[model samples]
Target: MSGFSPEWLALREPADHAAINAQVRLELVRVLAGKASPKVVDLGCGAGSNLRGLSPWLPAGQSWTLVDYDQRLLDAAQARVARSPLSPSPREGGGTSVTYRQADFSAGDFAPLIAGADLVTAAALFDLVSVPVIGKLADAVTANRQIFCTVLTYDGIASFLPEHPLDRAMREAFNRHQQTDKGFGPAAGPNATEALAQAFTSRGYRVIRAKSPWVLDQTFERLRRELDQGWANAVRETGAVPVREIEGWIAHRLAAQDAVTVVGHEDLLAVPV
Candidate 1:
């Protein structure tokens, strides 16, 4: 799997937290309500943004096994979480406990990581993986009767205000590049949410999905700038558009004072019926 730097993850964390679907989270709260302590395994944890976002809603005394390919990120996650109010010392009683594990599910078995988890959760991950991998995940979750929740999966919709002539072309090229392998097989990309929903539903699990789009305005200037550069890079990789046009589009987007960028994403909550 591709690695994400802590700085990049940090920059996007606020938007990611804001974009999470409240309804899906409410449903998850209901699903795990009765458990005294929920064991959650977070895939591609990446500095533990998902944990920091969702931990407060969960029951106290929760235990988390944060799994990531990068040990540096795991270390970062631990340090950050330790500083948060959420990670109170265990002696305080009912405080959350966390452990980090370095593992690459793309090249290793997933069953062990999820073996005893009550909930298997990930954020900003499914879109980068293949359908078969999702299916296998559904199978394991079903077998263990674990609740599955994933958020911030890109769905191929990106719109910018004060639209440029090359907007459509840039978006098309970027979406195509998204399907390229990110260490997994060919990615599902924009179709990931639908694929994940179908995978769980076909196994008789109840799946709920909701829109979780990033709506960035002037207040998110830094994130918008980063996104502009990232999209330009991805579009360049496809070679479907001229380099000059891509550069122009990025320049126009960054320079626009009243710019707004909305990137569509979806969140899913699957529960065993």
Candidate 2:
């Protein structure tokens, strides 16, 4: 919830599934290109992963502004940008022409900072925002005609060897948990994609939807562990079953020596319609 638990970040970064999502983000940039110097703003930038990923595709002279609620992530993102291949000013001329800003996207008016940017983006954030807030964002972006993209939304499919029923049960429960908004009021969870798509279409932007699903193979231990924990927590949160049963079910799946794959989808690419 706060900073993605360090263990979670460690396992997530090296995930093979992440590679697919990164590729989708890259393509999102390619589809919306037509500017001399685009001002790219990454909303809920989250350590600047999306920014760093977009650097190569973006114009060399282009500027970037990273926004997040956490200062710690902002600090780390700036440091990464300084060392990134796309650093605007090399040779110690200046430390990355990138600007880091702290802002709350849930309640505050976003048009002033984002209204005129060539592009605005976020990773794995759409499913977590409520419909009304997304409506406001669609209004703002439509007014400015900013290109927007988001990546890695969870679609809730988990499979392990032997095909246990618990896997299906846990996944559904987790999807429900994902819908529970953390602090930005009520959100409809994984279904946020539709709200975003509808909002953009109504405003007159041609939307290109791409699904980047994370399909993990059995060889990846880190991904297995992350999915296991995520499934367990989702089931536990519901208080619908006994803790011992959940433990036993998880143990059985992990103990079996076979390939396990969890499928999750992320939506990408929204342009002026």
Which candidate has the top score in TM-score? 1
Where is model 1 poorest over a 10-residue stretch in terms of lDDT? 84-93
For residue 15, give model 1's deviation from the true position in Å: 0.5
The residue-by-residue lDDT of candidate 2 on 161-272, one tens digit each, is 6677676676677777777775566775777777788989888887766666665666676677667766787789887667887898888867777756666665667787
Candidates in order, TM-scores: namely: 0.96, 0.85
Error of 2 at 248 (Å): 1.7
Off by over 4 Å in 1: 85-93
lDDT of 2: 0.69
What lDDT score belongs to each candidate, Candidate 1 first? Answer: 0.90, 0.69
